[model samples]
Target: MTTASGGWTVIQHRYDGSVGFYRNLSEYTDGFGNVGTEFWLGLSYIKEIADKGNTTIRMEVSAADGSSAYEEWPEFRLGDAPTYTLHVGGRGIGTAGDSVRYFEQGNNGSDFTATGSYCGDIQHGAWWHNSYCTYINLNGEYATPGTRSRYDNGWGGMVYFSFKDKSSLKMSTIMIRRND
Candidate 1:
């Protein structure tokens, strides 16, 4: 929340393995962990605040090698319950490519998938996911910079392939602010 734009609210943030991201459906809906550390600010709450007004989302990630990247969207908001579907407007610009909103066959809305299933299990966490996952995954198992596997199955950790093809990121944070 220390940006020049100011009034930024952290929706999710992870730096260390202090908090687990591989949580169940209820846990994701209700949320868990301490915001001061690693945490997901919950589902319903996210929808409530986002729907209140026009919002912009910023996703920042850092690699083990000290490299970092980010992608921002001019508009962002989640859908109603049962599935907090993600709706990312369009890509702004940043070092990291715009992968949040897949506008081809994938459309733009993606339902928030519960962890421990499909790509969530293989990728290690949950979020608004598409059939082809891994565009961006901040809510994944935390791992040290170099203490992880380089295989596909071993990719159950933080991933932002656009960031130098790094499957296991060192740090990541997602924050939102009302554009109004």
Candidate 2:
């Protein structure tokens, strides 16, 4: 779903443990002849609702498989607001060597900056690996990923958001399009 402003495409997912969703960009063959998506945008939100002691929300991404390229953003308690916004985009879509960026903000007056520049890997499948946000739970243990699972595979040219925890989360908006 998309917000009224049409700036962002909203997505909501409740997490019982480690979970993720992704949007594929394109298809390409890796240097080793492994065929997979050339570029992908994976968004994962980690939070424990019941445990107020754990007040950190982590957002992470997996891109350029086998290149050890990844991005993560963590936000602390901003306020009591339950809504959050994640803005992701790049200069060009389907363009080789284009850079991708991510930003986030919470209703509690918390803001997160975009991570460093990351380019899609054409040689290796830019698949979503086991990338997750940092979870800091003081009272309970956080979830973790055991293997690589494509939650939203074949969803290219789109945006996806996954939420994992006891509480239900809502996405107000999601914007995916050309920046210029």
Candidate 3:
């Protein structure tokens, strides 16, 4: 987290499979895991922060070899519950290629779906899916590098698609900072 700009809250972070991310809607809504470790800060909390004022989102992904990439969106806002929809604006700038904003027209307005999950194709995990799927499924299952092949064809792992064409991830972190 860039300490230079304070108030940057970590919305999600995962470095290992210690905490299961394949959870239900309730778990996603209420949040899970440890803030000091693998955790998702919860949609409710994310909404509250977004509602307060303008915000920016940053996503960083790394491979087992320590190679990493990051993406940043200048504008971000999450909707309220029931739908808990997502709205990410502006062209993301980073090494991750703005994958979230390039999934079939865009996943910008996709709803936060947890049922069946992973775009209803497989049980990768809950995420802000655009019906079919979102390119960036950071909340997907945690598949070790050795266990990636078996799940590659189905995107069954914590992955940032555009990074390596469904490449398995070793670590990832998402943070949001308010502009006002």
Candidate 4:
């Protein structure tokens, strides 16, 4: 499933992590002139091992031209029930560089609580160009250059999930969404 808004698109995917250490759940293309993109994911029916603190999950995004960025979450205990919701995305709100945030929520009885939150600048990575806006000639069509628009370089990207101890986990749901 997929949804779009103001030039950004999000797709949902289903994944089963019964036998691997890493799983690439979904991938997306942000066209050719988007400022930033966001992804939200949910995992259910989790089966964790006795040593849960070593298990990990990750989300990665890359430009169609090869530029990329990624963020990973910390380990959890077996008794935590394993279900989780994660959010990863970039925002063009700061002057230094594009601001990025990664957040995680773990299931607890009838509710979920924030487990992790991280912030960074997209310019720190070599995959992305520091210029917030740039002109591009697309199939003979000309586009204006500048950050006046929120999305200027709608590059392609992907989302992935990884586990440290594969034998202990069996995920049932891999709900994913993209937001601008």
Pick the TM-score winner. Answer: 3
CA lDDT of 112 in candidate 2?
18
Score residue 21 of candidate 2 by CA lDDT.
Answer: 25
lDDT string for model 3 (34-120, tens) is 988899888998889888888888888898667888887867888878778888777888887655556324677888887565463
TM-scores for every predicted model: 0.88, 0.21, 0.89, 0.24
lDDT of 1 by residue, 71-159 (tens): 77767888888788788776666768655434212525778886666877777788677887655667767877644533345466677
* lDDT for each residue of candidate 2 in 1-53, tens digit (9 for 90 to 100): 23222332212222232322211221111111111222212222211221233
The number of clashing residue pairs in each candidate reads 0, 10, 0, 12
- Candidate 1 lDDT: 0.74
Order candidates by lDDT, high to low.
3, 1, 2, 4
Q: Please give the CA lDDT of all the candidate structures.
A: 0.74, 0.21, 0.76, 0.21
Q: Which parts of model 4 have CA positions greater than 4 angstroms off?
A: 1-51, 76-100, 104-180
Model 2 alpha-carbon drift over 4 Å, by segment: 1-51, 77-101, 105-180
- Taking all chains together, the TM-score of candidate 3 against the true structure is 0.89
- Please give the distance, in angstroms, between residue 7's alpha carbon in candidate 2 and its true position after superposition: 34
Error of 2 at 79 (Å): 7.4
The number of the candidate with the highest lDDT is: 3
Q: Cα miss at 167, model 3 (Å)?
A: 1.7
